[model samples]
Target: MTAEPILTISGLNVDYGTGANGVRALRDIDLTLHRGEVLGLAGESGSGKSTLAYAVTRLLSPPGVITGGDVHYHRPGGGEPVDILSLTPDELRAFRWQELSIVFQGAMNSLNPVHTVHSQLTDVLTAHRPGMRAAERTARAEELLTLVGISADRLAAYPHQLSGGMRQRVMIAMALALEPEIVIMDEPTTALDVVMQRQILRKLVELRERLSFSVVFITHDISLLIEFSDRIAIMYGGRIVEQAGAAEIYRDPRHPYSDGLLHSFPALHGPRRELTGIPGSPPHLSAMPTGCAFHPRCGKAFEPCAERVPALAPPDAGQDREVACWLHH
Candidate 1:
């Protein structure tokens, strides 16, 4: 059964500056994250994957600005949607970790080098749950460590004391400290080895199942998403080119960019295949190509691809999927 929508992003647009000098980073992006499911967002380095995460969390700084659109969080237990964009400073602070939390890319480095793990974990609780006593906070901190498969003994240790995976798990522990309904993880396993990455993702999935919180896992690793995500959304040039069930995307990708991304990863179990990296680099937002931004590199591009933008819509197939390409239209 399809889960209820937990977060709805409508007509979302982002730009770097104001007026003509501004460069568009995101354009009319629409997405829905369902309750208790892992939604994977994947693309190349500059495809605006991180930007989308930061924008959704309102963590974008300086020149980054939300030009338009609304991000609505559908409160659990069937409450009215709360417009995140409309939140005031105090409301925004209270809304952040208590409702939506993010485990940023390279999150391990985000830990404070000087503070003990116990202190860091408790700080979140102290800030959010002011009524809790100091002893209660310490006990909860230990429990959080144990929940992430780390020993409570490490709570007193500094950030440098733990291994890479342990540190990453510590970050996960912090994000879950508040038991938020949605957790946005931006490439949570960037430098970890394959085995470690798989282990972390597996543990994350296990925790999600038990905790019942939705996840927006961002990564450039298509294969990892194929293994772990319930649904996959492929981004190209700051827009989602295709989105569908993970298996459907792997079996039959509709967009040319999606196909390219899927093929970029090496196959492990299938017959040996040569890896073909996506041709050409992504277009610069300042001088974006007319029409489809990917048309410059898309092998399937025709005259229309260069002249008109393709709206994301259902393809000829009846499957529950959406694609943005003139070829499908």
Candidate 2:
């Protein structure tokens, strides 16, 4: 039998406010995360990829509230399943980085410009494991750095003194400081150039192999997801349109949006040509249409698409992938 999921989200709805004031950032969302697997969430900007990540980690800012549904986080610590949507501030403090951690995009900002890498790394160790003495913390910091392919000597250098790739590795080291079972990486390599991006990606694969932690990776680049993730979930306008194994998603995209996204990237070689994007932008959350949010830009959208929001249903039992598009369902 399959193991229970480490992170389970069901009917998750995040609204900006009350009644008519409500803006649906996410609606009827569902996801399951298994141990030691990478689940990639891909979408264009404003499609609510980050919103779902934020909601999962209980990190959403003011005005955005979990209006309905549940986020059930099952940790190895043997505590009751945490209802992340209802966490108190004190509870959240105890949970962050210990049970759940995030590697934010532009994570360089997370590192202090003035402090040495040793200091920053030590801070996370000290905070999470308060019983650890300086010597223990130092050893732990060095161990984590080694895991990311960086030497312990670099610990003496400040953030500004490091290259972009090194700084990114340091940030990753800090996130792994707590050795949490799960890490939510929100476009973690967006700011880096291609080479640096690959370097980090390689290290992440290595780190995951060593630590055996699951990852909820969010990004706009479908090609990167194909390279780094085990499975992919395609999000469009606050809803999941398609989800499947990365190979299957690319090999045969059932949804038109997924197809467009797959085609939008530049040709890798020969020409290295400039690419064109999908026709329009994601819908404004404050003012969404009555039917499908993607119908405006979806090529296969027809009469039924304008009148009903299709559920994520599989065409057959043999095919495990689920898609919400009317044409596919």
Candidate 3:
């Protein structure tokens, strides 16, 4: 069954620094993540996928500011939606990990080398569920490890002792400790090999099914997104150029940037074809093109594309998908 919308992002804009010299890292972005569904975010390295993830979780560091936007999270039990952007520091602390958790990029490296897996897992529960007794926390830690496919025996091992994939799974287990309604993973598999990456993602989907949490999976790999995501949103130069169902995007992408990204990866089953990557580098945020930031790199660019920026909207009539390009206009 299709789940109800869990999070809504509207007119989201992020900038680095303040003043006329500030660079726009994310354009006005509007997106919706449904409950228990996986939404894949794809783009080049500098396209602001990670920025959006951090922005949503209110985790962005110094010099980064949200110039405009509203991020709303609907309560799980049909309660009134809360404005995430407006939460106070104390409220944010209570909200995170309980309502939503994020597994950051290179998350395996984030584990404390000095602490055992058992200690770390228990720490999260200890902080959030202060009333839980020591024995209960220990049992919960072992259960969490088991949920992520890690044996309870590994609980006493330090981060350095675990393999890279195991470390990633541990991070995932920690994220799920609070049973948050949503989990945002940013390039969680970057350091793992292909086989391990596949295993981790597959296991993640299994856990999602069992736990009923939505996912915002951010990665630059379009092929990976196609295989795992229910819906895919393609971003370029910090703006989303296209968004649609994964199958619809793979079969009939409406934007040139999305098409370019799809073709950049080779298909394991389909007939062989020459692999050609998109030409020209991504636009620098400081000197982004006036109209469309992707126009210079888009092979399908034309007169109107260079003169006026196209808003993300549905193409023609009777289509649910949206694209930001003059080709459809």
Candidate 4:
């Protein structure tokens, strides 16, 4: 990964309602995505992983609002960074598919059931590249299908005619139609089987390498993130608990939550061992814990963990690692 940052998010805050009754979904989030690198976001359901993605893309709907944050996109080469939150509606529309695109969680739900695959793929090109001829659009659509390993003949197939994996590939094709600089994928492989998931992930890595675009890959699977991402950020109760290189996170996770997540998954190539999943359900948004959200469930929680929230900072135990836990702080 390059040292230059392509996307930077600072002091991000989000809420699900308005006024005094609002429940904060994300709190003081700060993250950076370097150019041509994949940054993986891992957390359990309702941890605000999807919320952060939607907020960054400005796709958050009603009842879900970005209360505070600054999202800046630094274009290629030297130029003024674009403030994403400040963009007008028209500018944001143009910016969406051209600069950034997203593949939502479910492919079947994302694709239009009535529309043909060819039309859906070409629609993106036609909307963004208005000057292109019909033949060119058709050619581009076929190329996109080919890029995603789908047969060109499938272009005529409707959503229901294709398999789940193919539908997901079509969604990926649409996301890449404009060749955006950044792609946010929210559990793109959640519906697929293990074999299909690996195939899709491998294809995505190949595409990222060839296209040189940055990616924000969000999922609950920490193991998958460790294998495919350049860096990993662990979130708990909407707050980032740890951020570090994939290898570093896998080998030595300083945060208790991170350690728990690592232990939750089974080892593929190691001696047989019993799985020790984290105890207790994730805290509800309305009744979040006093200080550290994970303290109630943390095996290593101490007095300080319950008294004050720990800032995500580099720990003395390692370099280039940040953990938000009193034990490390």
Instruction: Give lDDT per model, in order.
Output: 0.93, 0.86, 0.93, 0.93
User: Looking at model 1, which ten-residue stretch has the lowest summed lDDT?
Assistant: 311-320
lDDT of 1 at 190: 95
RMSD of model 2 against the true structure: 2.3
Q: Report the C-alpha lDDT of model 3 over 7-102, residue by residue, as the tens digit.
A: 999999999998887999999999999988899999999999999999999999979999999999998778889999999999999999999999
- Show the colliding residue pairs in model 2: none
TM for every model, in the order presented, reads 0.98, 0.94, 0.98, 0.98
Each model's backbone clash number? 0, 0, 0, 0
lDDT of 4 by residue, 171-205 (tens): 99899999999999999999999999999999999
Q: Report the C-alpha lDDT of model 1 over 33-145, residue by residue, as the tens digit.
A: 99998999999998889999999999998799998999999998887899999999899999999999999899989999999999999999999999999999999999999
Better of 1 and 2 by lDDT: 1
Candidate 3 whole-model C-alpha lDDT, 0 to 1: 0.93
Q: lDDT tens digits, residues 206-249, model 2? A: 88888888899999999999997988999987899999989999
Local error of candidate 1 at 101, Å? Answer: 0.2
**Which pairs in model 4 have colliding backbones?**
none
Residue 240 Cα positional deviation in candidate 1, in Å, after optimal superposition? 1.0
Query: How much does each candidate deviate from the true structure in C-alpha RMSD?
Result: 1.0, 2.3, 0.9, 1.0
